[model samples]
Target: MSAYAEITYEVEDRIATVTLNRPEARNGYTIRMADELGDAMDRADRDEDVRVVILTGNGKDFSVGADLTQGGFDFDPETGPDAAWQEPAGRCSKRIFTMNKPVIAALRGAAVGGGVTITLSCDYRLASTDSRFGFVFVRRGIYPEGASAWFLPRLVGMGTALDWMISGRVFGAEEAKTAGLVHSVHEPEEVLGKARELAREIAATTSPVSVAVTRQLLYRMASAESPFPVHELDSRLIGGLGSSPDAVEGVVSFLQKRPPEFSMRVDTDQPAYLPWLNK
Candidate 1:
């Protein structure tokens, strides 16, 4: 019943797995795939049963970047870059940035250009020993897209982002992990399994509403100008959750030596001041 054309979405337990299905083409990023990815992200965010999402490819490569086989001169002659052509990777990245559930990118092979930028928006990335990454936009006679200019610097620092982007060179998974681009690296066939295990761990241990609010707060406050605003937000959240049912259950369960079964649902129980209006 899934409407996706280039991706496969399957939900098991509390984890939603979104797989890029274009293996023959190395899971290249295309307009249709971008739209579908955004849709899949929305689905995961809206589904209360889905606590986490894992993004991976159906083939050897996570993604080889954009598909160029559409031939040259495909852009509108009159509008050019200003044409209504929104960058596909940007669409997917934007959705991931705002998702309620955490996303983990599982990379096995090549992740170039759009490939690298799209994953940059995810909360965590796990790669295989055989994985490779490239920021080859400059080499392709273009600059980085998918808001990578902002994401890359925030992730690996300005100097590292500039060096890799300027050089447009391919790098291995170990280098990426050392640069703070990825959380962990495992054997090729174990990459997706490891990602799933992590997702399950989070889903099992965390409260959905708390996780959603905390994720937004962390990402939003990361670029804030001052700590005062974050303190205010923290106070507001704590005041709201302090006496809630989940809070009581969490404390009681700990005292009794048992797992806490939080009763609040994110959809209806989220604090009124959530999302930080100014952010």
Candidate 2:
């Protein structure tokens, strides 16, 4: 929002594209890049006109990990939340995690260390056939950032997560798909195009408020230990649909064989009764 130097944010046709802008260094990870990315995601989430977000890097490789040439990460344990301190990658990934809008990550070439970790919270990941991914923290003598340890296990299972994190080795697109890390694989030239196509489809058909609710439910409720709480929440949501204009529009449009015109906005129409909002 405040003149981003490390990333670019653009919104068109209801899709916000946030691209990593450091092409000269293969979009290397940096503190400034992390802050810019977090700001971009927050901007997209709050904009009613933006229904979907597509995240991709500018050049051939998504990112070659950190820019060691500029000297690696330096952190101070004494830095507090009020101070100018936040873990680099989590600032971006955590912002994406809280977003009501769906996010799709488009990857090509290498996505290693901080690169792949930052995208772990995205709802979907579409990578090029030549794309390679890694959690190379151990090899680099630094531990993982971005809360990837939590996200990675949920995505690829404990076994695969352990294998990748402990070994610190890179894997290709096919293996990423097989492990459920990436949703789909595409040609390098077609990956971003495919992401845009998917974003358009989501923006055109789905109810914004419904997608927002569903996104939160999947990320929060699905991980709960008890199904009773989910059932209670689901019943409440279903009951509220009777009073929802968008719900009526959905059914009427279907009967008329036309595109649904949902009037509910994600920013204002999301139900305030949600129990997880405070936490």
Candidate 3:
């Protein structure tokens, strides 16, 4: 709800679009941009009507990464009102990582370093055919930020992550898709449109509460050391189905061959017993 100077947040028809508005600078990343992005994402997440989020930039490039022209030192965290200090990109990535709703990234032109890393947590990435990607930290005599080391390998495997990070080479969209780093590729002008189509599909066919719970379960439990905890949690989730109106609607609608009219809301209907939500 607060005003944003560096980015734009707009919601319509159950989807929220958060855009990097600095097209003139190729949407260069900055400390202010990072804060604005984190706030916009949090705003969308808190809005019960927003079932999905589309993240993209204006103009040709998604971002040229951090704006080193004005001393890249500005992106690092020395201290803040929050109890802990986190790198700017990490702050955005972490917020996206924990969201109940799905976040999709639409990339075009150049998306290197922090630009690409900041989007690593998005559920889907739709890249423009002309998109260029890189993890060019080593070549620039710096380390990668945005907790990319943890996110990159999980998306593209250890071997590929190492190859890209160690070599610090830029690659095109097809290679990114082939390696599972991106979900799909589209024409330069169609990237954001494709993202919106995908968002609308999710918004139309899914229960908000169900999507929220499932998204959190996958991210929160994917790295677990064992399956015992997951199964235990799964049992708990399934047992709650008896009390879930959406669950019954899902089955009844299928039997009747009709579009489901689910009545669950993410903010109010999520299971109160979830460990993360409870904690």
Candidate 4:
């Protein structure tokens, strides 16, 4: 496992846990941390030992978004002269969109600004009872970075997304779930446990090859309009994965009424672009 000032990683029972470690600062993302996280996700996706990835924060708050007081990067449009604000935006965008493995965010604290965007990127999201979520970009005199401008509206609908982002108001875990941001809420202590449990369930039942293909397809469909090209991509992916060793193992295991022993290795040589670049 690599060391990161803002995050930590561990693997157990085929589940890879990626924790936001900077609790004192509310797990805020620094530029370097963002890059490290992206690299970590890439590693997790490529490693056959890892079947699922859980994302969580160490302290009371999940993440408060970008570290503003730390200096170097300024999001304040009034104070900043030009488009320097887009630097952090671009970095975060890359991190959220490029993760290949299924990510489940275990939320125990406030998820604000870029934090909300991160949570939205995950395949599944679980929040603790004490958790709170919001987008504070408007209050900070900036727009939501890290795909919030696009993801939020799509996840919660245009009207709700606009209201939440523009108001910059804080919402509790229950409200977040109701608004379709979080899938479920659990006790503070059970937050990560529930996330892990869910991950294990997925790992136990889902076909590794199919899961990866589905994740890619869903991501591509989120922003793309041309169904023809998307279908072509899907066909190609399925065609290749259908003949994989894992695919055969999955079917054989089902026939034998036993758990599949998935080979974690997967091919990812497909073309990078096919719409939904913002996600």
Candidate 5:
């Protein structure tokens, strides 16, 4: 409920919606926005009342990358010793990657540079018909950030990732869909509604702990050396969930032909073998 200068956070129907509020600036990415975003994500992850998250921007554009008015301290090598050499966008992206709840990005208008890379960590991206994505770092004489080097290739493919980032060209939502970057594109007015509908569906039907465990398993095992590790994880998770209360409800509801009333909470009821690799 706290006010954020660069973003707005609201929770309704178990879905936490984080809106980038700099409409006049086209939601220009800024250090303050990044910090606020990190805080918002942490709030969502820790709130048991929240089951899903939707991230989007205000006004015509999702984001136009960072604000150019701030000078080049972001790219300047001589800024300071305490600058930490970390891209601000990485902090927000990492938060999204580690979230227990599903994240859906509703992108409209232009999503260029950091705009595109930041959304890469989201579980799903739904864009507007007028949306355009650009990895314009190359054109700006910089390199890609937000850990896109790893996520981009995995989401699309090495070939598509290279073609997009290396070229630094702007592409439409349809091309983004063809490249596997976006799930669906809608009219500008309907994009947010579509994202919310998906979030509501997930929040209304899925088991929180199961969804959390599944997210971690896929993300962790994708780069795994072999399928054996995944198999092992699968067995462990199945063993833990088979007798859980949620599993019992899941089966009973199915046999009775009714909606499930899953009671497990992600904050406290996640499996004992969470972060499965660490186990």
Candidate 6:
């Protein structure tokens, strides 16, 4: 087990659980924490032992957003072509978006500001009944970063996105589910367990190559404005995996009435790019 003060990672049955460990601060993300998270995800992506990644927080909250007191609120626009204002959050956002394995967010408390942005990057989100969500950048007189400006509108509609981003209103779990921010809501105690179960199910059935390719295509379709070249990318992905061993196993298993044994291997050496980062 590799150790981290702000985050923890563990692998079992090809499922990797990456937990936000700053409970005393309600799991807020400091700049250091953001860096640690990116590193952890990178480790998971490179490790063949990890086929799925589950992200959750320790203690009572998922994340209260950036730690303002720890200078998480500090941002400057004049740092040059690559400004500091964009570096930290942008790096973290890219990490989540480009993660090859499926990433699930387990929310048990407030997910605000950057916290909400992190949740938005997840492939699926399961929130506890007591969880609350808010896009609080406007309240602090700052614009939403971490691709929330683009991601939120796509998840919900533009109107609802505007309402949340501009108004900075707090919404409960049901509202979040209604707005498509979360896939399901469970009891507070069940949040992590349910996330683990979902991860296990996905791990049991999904081929590593198929999951990575599908995740790449979905991210492209959602964040890319011009869909012109995406078709080519999709065709390339499908053509490459059409005759893979896992794909053959999947088909044969169905005909033979047996569970498929998928190979959890990714041939790609680099993580895919996230379009949201360009904006």
Cα error, candidate 1, residue 9 (Å): 0.3
> Using Cα atoms with residue i matched to residue i, what is each candidate's TM-score against the true structure?
0.94, 0.95, 0.95, 0.84, 0.95, 0.88
Runs of candidate 6 with Cα error greater than 4 angstroms are 72-87, 223-230, 237-242, 268-279
Alpha carbon deviation, residue 127, candidate 1 (Å): 0.4
User: What lDDT does each candidate get?
Assistant: 0.88, 0.91, 0.92, 0.76, 0.89, 0.81
Task: Please give, for residues 231-267, the per-residue lDDT of candidate 3 as tens digits.
Answer: 9999999988999999999999999999888998888
RMSD to true structure for each model, in Å: 2.1, 2.0, 2.2, 3.6, 2.0, 3.6
Tens-digit lDDT string for candidate 6 (1-279): 256878888888888888989999998888888878888988998887788899999998999888868854445435544343454566677788887799999989888888878767889999999998999888889878888887788888999999988899999999989888899999999998999899988888778877886787787675556777787666665666554778788999989998789864775522244232224
Give the candidates in order of lDDT, highest first. Answer: 3, 2, 5, 1, 6, 4
Using lDDT as the yardstick, the better of models 2 and 6 is 2
lDDT of 2 by residue, 54-93 (tens): 9999999998877866644556436635556667888888
RMSD of 4: 3.6
Q: The CA-based lDDT of model 3 is what?
A: 0.92
> What lDDT tens digits, residue by residue, belong to model 4 across residues 71-125?
6464455677475445654565456556556889899878887776766778888
Write one digit per residue (lDDT tens) for candidate 1, span 1-279.
268778999999889999999999999888778889999998998899999999999989999999877443336657676646677788899889988799999999999988879999898999999999999988989979999998998899999999999999999999999999999999999999999999988987778888888888888888889899889888887877666888888788889988878888877887876665334
Please state the error at residue 129 of candidate 4 in Å. Answer: 1.1
> Model 2 Cα RMSD, Å?
2.0
Which candidate would rank higher by lDDT, 4 or 6?
A: 6
- Model 3, which residues run further than 4 Å from truth? 74-83
lDDT of 1 at 229: 84
